[model samples]
Target chain A: MVAKLKDQMTPAERASALARGEKVDRLPCNPNIANGAARIYGCKISEFNTNAKALAEAQIAVYRRFGSDSIRIFTDLFTCAEAMGAKAILPEDNTADLLEPAISDLSQIDRLRPVDPYKDGRLPVQVEAMKYLVDAIGTEAGCSVGVVGPFTNSFFLVQMEKALQLICKDPEAMHKLCRISLESCKAWAAVVMDMGLTPTISEPMSSCTVVSPRVFREFSLPYLKELVDFIKSRGRGVTMHVCGQTNKIWTDLADLGIAGMSIDNVASIRQCKESIGDQVKVLGNVDPGSVMYAGTPMDVRLATLECIRDGYDSPKGFVVMSGCSLPVETPVENIDMMMDTVREAGYPIDIEWVEAEIARCKQVLGK
Target chain B: MRTKEELLAELARCVVEMEDDSVADVAREYAEAGHDPKEGILNGLIIGMNQAADLYDQEEYYIPELLICSAAMYNGLDVLKPLLPQEKQENEQKIVIGVVQGDTHDIGKNLVKIMLEAAGFTMIDLGRDVPVERFVDAVRAENPQVVALSTLMSTSMQNMGRVVQLLEEAGLRQQVKIIIGGGPVSTAFARKIGADGYSVNATDAVHLVRELLGA
Candidate 1:
């Protein structure tokens, strides 16, 4: 089902209109395509992530080829840790990793210096990429600078187990570490916002799968609310994402005052629509790991149709997106399948065509 | 003068409460008063960890609780290991575990290690971001009966498969079982990658290894 769009606005315009509660041509297709771009350009991910010029070129290559509704500048989850004085292992063809956290104990958390996004490891590379995108494609192109949310960044600075233990064992220290993370996020987001880039805060480990709602409310919620308020206070937009089963905290997330949300596949977009009632923009929830990276093109089409159908009738707006970051080796054919479906989906969905495609895809991607 | 059962129960309570510091105090008391340290662990410390594991199975305790309980359990282990018979220590079944290459998420792997050690399996933890070839080397060196592989990233999912193939090429596949688990791993992926078994939670990993060994 190839869609020849008659009314194709720039991705920036469509996203802006959708978030503003106005009519849109179709849902914006802006999955967080990070290292996947590195693969497309045939460059080592380690090199692509570190070099500003290479990062810009890879993003530009993806933008030109895919015509995805939005362009996201993502370095890695560990950039926040690396920026805060932790040593990171950046591999040749993989995402950067920091084995030892910045804080070995709670006492050290206070000593962590605030990161300057300009001079920090590869953060400037990210900001420059965002600048390059805005320059090359004009401001009409959708763009967001990705930042790690405070809750997950806490784990980045301290080991996940030790950090989580602090939640129940020593919540006072946990709260303080979260405050430190919040300060770091504000510092980083301010830099990107000053560059005219929207900051998208992603908390991959903040899902129900990792922390129960009680823990989330105590540790993650207030900090997130603060982050959103800070971004909004500056009169700019912010997007928030959590990587796995987040249905438990969906309402809290909707009320966090972000322009939009990106959810993982385990979260049903239909439920998300009901919970929020179109008060905020909803993006995402195709299983990036299983359906997009592992499954065939037909699986991608099926998953894309499922997300659209569930969220198409929402009150706020929805963008068709992968639930999370595309793996380093995500297949382009599957990506094209998602793009094609979004282009053809026609605003106020073409149910008849969609029904036909769903039926056809069912046959192709049968259980 | 507390009964033997009552003293052990007190020791068990220390672990269940996640009091790492006071657990050693209770162990020393149990030892000074003539209670067997090995039994202090088996019927005392291990029992407490077993209760924690049960709570974990019921979703009452999570990673944090388990880690604290493991800390308490290790506190008791440190006091009791010196008392265990040398023959008992030398003859225990061993298991090799690691987070596969390219994957650094080891909280799950660490949990499994804690549970397995509490269950009395000697573990050789290869640590996170482990090379694929090391699985074969560990299997060769440790002669362990099970090689457990874990990865949290989807990109590193293929490395689990590579470890399996490496075991096959090294002719060590049949000598020991391969078990895999993590966020992105599934039973289907395990089968596709030729792993012998897959368990989503760390608690179930002990059972999987037991079933593989017919224990």
Candidate 2:
């Protein structure tokens, strides 16, 4: 049936239709969830962050309850960083943060070789959780796992401030730390793939729009290139989530052998489709905060439809997702709206809904 | 025999000095020169810091550069504070800033605080991960016109709502405008929690302060 639908559509039509973009049966809803789903299962964020089983169960339960298309398994950016030696601080009042350094000093890099994910800090726990998830629902249900990018891991290793300074003062030390971070991530990526899960890495700092594109290249790029290669060599799809305004390095990132790039609202999705849309999958640009948090479920549905509409034809890929992690306070119904939009709209859709959103834009343009 | 170049140089010098104590000099030099305090702020310090903010956005500048420049701007504002006419000085708004509980992400919050201070608001920084009670107590104690909350983690968003609710429960909501922004914070979330404003970056946060204060 999917092939038949693709036969009737344009290349963009085929891609969006497969993904259930607007004009298709309905849009695919695959928003990134951290520990937020834990609330749905009556689990604490602390439990959700530390215990892989609880985390997996809560994600599964939430996806099942909400009728979501995929269950994203990301327990904050500190998971892989922890395995590299950063201590995970799962606080009750906030997202899990790293408590210990992955490397206290550059000397520790030689001492801090990457361990097998199965034997490392919490990797086995995560793999076991994925295995449990696979056992319960299987791959037809769509399960995704997260790997922290080297730069973010390095951020935890020496703290964000110290890391940012080093980008300017000690580029070589930053590069070495990036390597360790990559080793840890590659280890997790290997394990997640073995468990039959799609691997996605979140590059929180690759956007010079956040840090510097130069720093991103000097401190982040080479190692990330290696991790991407590792994932591909394993025959798994590699999704890159570059948070913040990353238009500055969009082409650079797209050229890095990534299968998908998750973007925030800062960059125009259409522009992204035009630039790297053909090279890899493009998944996102939705202001998850606005539509998912402040707007009504219908608003989320409509805004998602708009994203799908704008993303109608891409090079090789498109996935409906929020520009960043879904806010913890995001109403579950809003998430459901995204899936519903995809399911309802099907594929090859556009901006009539955008007309309402564009009122602010119009006022800005004085049209 | 003051050269035009010398005067401009002095202007730059005083602008840096404005942040020295209370930014009184920032206000004073302009007031003495028969210039608008708002114009003085725009052309002199805010403009410079804004450039710094741009450099930050472009990766052309880093935190140390941002922090020290903001510090210099804040000091210039200090030197200008007492020198400004009483009306313009009094017109300067008061802003209350804090990092919500359970978040030790101080760099972004501190940057916003510095930006706000540079924008000439009397800032009461409650520091990082402040409890709800403290936010309430600080508000009651300082009676700031606006309350700005920062939280970098998705987990602390609930705390932000609690702080907003606490202010509302205390019947202080009407008197204080609430603004929130940080990594992991969305404008939608801010509106969902009944905050008056949200901005994506520190520059926007400073601009939002202007809008919230009706300046």
Candidate 3:
């Protein structure tokens, strides 16, 4: 068994020091565990998301087990949109599937109204979960709630293909939908901020892999900038996660004045560190599917070390995280290996040792 | 007063330019000019769709552009398809496709379907949130040349493999090629699940089907 390395500071202290550009005991690690928390807490996926107590208890359980730096409150990206009259099909053991969009046609744009976090759909459940988490572990570890970005939320209000079609065929209607979606986002963020938590934007649909950088510039960027500015105006820093290829818009994303960016595994972390590391804190991007969910412990250790090697010396800071939400079926041992690897290779990472270990892990894993 | 060549070129240009609202008028004009409807579809709309695919491959166009271009192609198809002699539509190669069970995200599946249709395969779309039994039933009913499964979530990825298993158990696996694609699926996962192939994108999906069916 690998001996555990002792941390010199609590997660909160480490996060504070890192924000202030000071040294800390270890590299902060957050594997973007969301649904997986329910598995750890021994509850059905449906209950874990809908019941605030279950959600909070599950997150606390995962944090206790993995000792990741942050308690991330995320159910799915569609919660806010679901609140605004979109129909979703909930499964007993999977995230809710959107059944019907709120505005199936642009002609129905008038039907969308800003959500009330406390009274609408599942936003209240999420807010209640945040309250429980903040009261329980807010002082010991950092906490953030996943808020869907305006552009992605807009698509949730309409069918995705129709929404993309509107980008070329009907820009005005697209803007109208996005304008209303932004209002829902702000309402949710305001609720989160009132509880003193950062609202991390998860914009899975806005990735360049789905839409071109030009589309992002015209449709997503302006709205994202407004959301980020609004968060900043509240005197809170914001982080963002875009789920697939983002290298095309690294500079544009950096220009948003975001404090941190969670890159997907599909994008090059090394390039991200080089291009925008000086501007924003770089977090991410181990392969959540191949490594964390499908591979063995050794594979997890190797990927974790590789991420630390690539991102450890960023000018702003770095947080080791999964490329996206950890699949609910990810083996617990793989997560243990990730945390162990991070703990073993704590701050002032020994480049020589990390390189050697990476080599050894690769050989053992036959990669 | 235009030549057949001029009409075909105009049809293709309308699609490539994403003239979704007007491509059908060009198709109707081609039909009114006593041109071959099949020629109008093959040399006109499909050619333009292929050009759009090439642009998507080159990153000169993206999803929004592809979606609109496909709309144009479909609009043109609506005008030209019924004008075809009945027997012409019967022998096209067929493929069954869907987003696997427990996953509802279908833009990727829709793109692949569009590309395959543009490439001339008749797609038996099961749509999203398809149960595993439905896949086996479709193969029994359609006898398609290929079965393509998709899922954006890793949790539902196992259902793709289940479909393969049920097909084999029903003694139907030998008749069709199985292909899978999506955000979390990989060639390694495809091989593990005994699928015939995996594609990384919609364009590649069309090529994979062709290669699998030896088309």
Which candidate number has the best DockQ?
3
Model 1 reaches an interface RMSD of 1.8
Among these predictions, the greatest lDDT belongs to 3
| Stretches of candidate 3 exceeding 4 Å from the true structure | A1-8, A20-23, B88-92
**TM-scores (chain A) of the candidates:** 0.94, 0.85, 0.97
By lDDT: ranked, best first = 3, 1, 2
Model 2 ranges with Cα > 4 A deviation: A1-27, A48-52, A92-94, A103-111, A139-142, A348-367, B1-51, B57-93, B184-194, B211-215
Fraction of native contacts in model 3?
0.61
Q: What are the per-residue Cα lDDT tens digits for candidate 3 across B91-199? A: 6799999999878788899999999998989999999989999999999999998999998998877798899999999999999999999888778778878999999
Please give the lDDT score at residue B184 for candidate 1: 75
- Candidate number that wins on lDDT, 1 or 2: 1
What are the RMSDs of all candidates, in order? 2.9, 7.0, 2.0
lDDT by residue (tens digit), candidate 3, A1-367: 4876556787899988877878888899998788888889999889955799999889999988888888888888788889998987777977777888887667779878999999999888888988899988958987889899999998879887778888887899999988999999999999999987889998887898889998889989999999999999999989999988999998898899999999999888899999999999999998898678877788789989999999998998889999999899999988888888988997788999999999998888677
DockQ of each: 0.47, 0.27, 0.66
**Tens digits of lDDT, candidate 2, A248-361:** 788888888887878887677898899889888888866765566656765665567567766756767577888888767778767666665565545444456444544543
Please tell me how candidate 3 rates in CAPRI terms: medium
